[model samples]
Target: QFVLPDANLGVIAFIRLAGIKADQLLKNCPKEYWVPGLTYMSEWSHQWLDYVTRTSGRLTKSVRFCDLGDFKMSMLEREVTRRDGEAMGVMEDCYPQLLQTVFLCNASSWIQVPWRLLRPIMPKRVTSKFEIISPETNVHERKMLLQYIDEENLPTRFGGKNAVWPVHFPLPEN
Candidate 1:
């Protein structure tokens, strides 16, 4: 998922799904919920998907194959603690919409597979006009950002050298 703030900067979310397996990707979405498994996407990210899907621009899925065979997906599940009554799980199947949204995103996608993930069964990658390079470390990531992001807007963490830091906010207790 990404955030295109007025198209000047593209914020691509490159989260590491360390111990998660293919089927366990949305393990905490809860089958009983009205939103089905897609709840794991969060309302905010779904809005971003709506925007990017309509525009068909600046989306990438760079995957890496890591050795995580011993990791337990069950261990990652969060316990339910409710302050309000029955607000979380209201069952309805939302898989169709989720599938369609994913398909639309894939239509305008640039997928990158690290060399370790290259397999004979994998599909051939199509060439993209837009350059979507995934740098290994923060140093390399900063260099890649230099091409698309201006020095003023880029974060210091990514080697922007900007003096100011982004505001930190605590997560909502809800």
Candidate 2:
């Protein structure tokens, strides 16, 4: 459910595939498929920037790269550190300025290992950006998401009153 919750607050939800072989997730996504999607993001971000200019609105933009299937760290690392890693370089290089907040969801602490590995390799500008996912927050996750998004727009897994999840992709093969 990638949405600009309000015109004033351009919030988007981009769900990354988790708990899968890294190659299938990004490394092996065909160039034809990969290139266009990257192009779309570049275009869409420019649109968002233009909207900001016209509206004179200040917003906190966020990207949620969810670990929906509870991916393990080993799988997570390949997507970020591997040289042929598709989205990794693009995200770190291209997407930084457009976003103010980023978070990872449903992933475990194994994130630390890969994060540490990638941290040294990334430039200061990239390294400064942080993705926070806190399950231990005082408020529940469902309530937290609902605070910004109306219940009707949220995925059911987030305790949304409307809309089932898997809105984009179908069930993964075991």
Best by TM-score: 2
Q: How do the residues 83-167 of candidate 2 rate in per-residue lDDT, one tens digit apiece?
A: 3355446654765566554445554556756776888888877665564344333246545555455667555544455455454
Please, what is the whole-model Cα lDDT of each candidate in the order they appear?
A: 0.34, 0.53
Cα error, candidate 2, residue 134 (Å): 3.6
Candidate 1 lDDT, 1-174, residue by residue in tens:
233322322223322233344444335445466243335533444454445555666542221112222334443434322311122232113222321111101111123344224434445332221233333233554465555445554444344544443312232222
> Which parts of model 1 have CA positions greater than 4 angstroms off?
1-11, 14-29, 34-43, 49-114, 117-121, 125-142, 145-174
For every model shown, the clashing-pair count is 1, 0
> RMSD, each candidate, Å?
11.2, 7.0
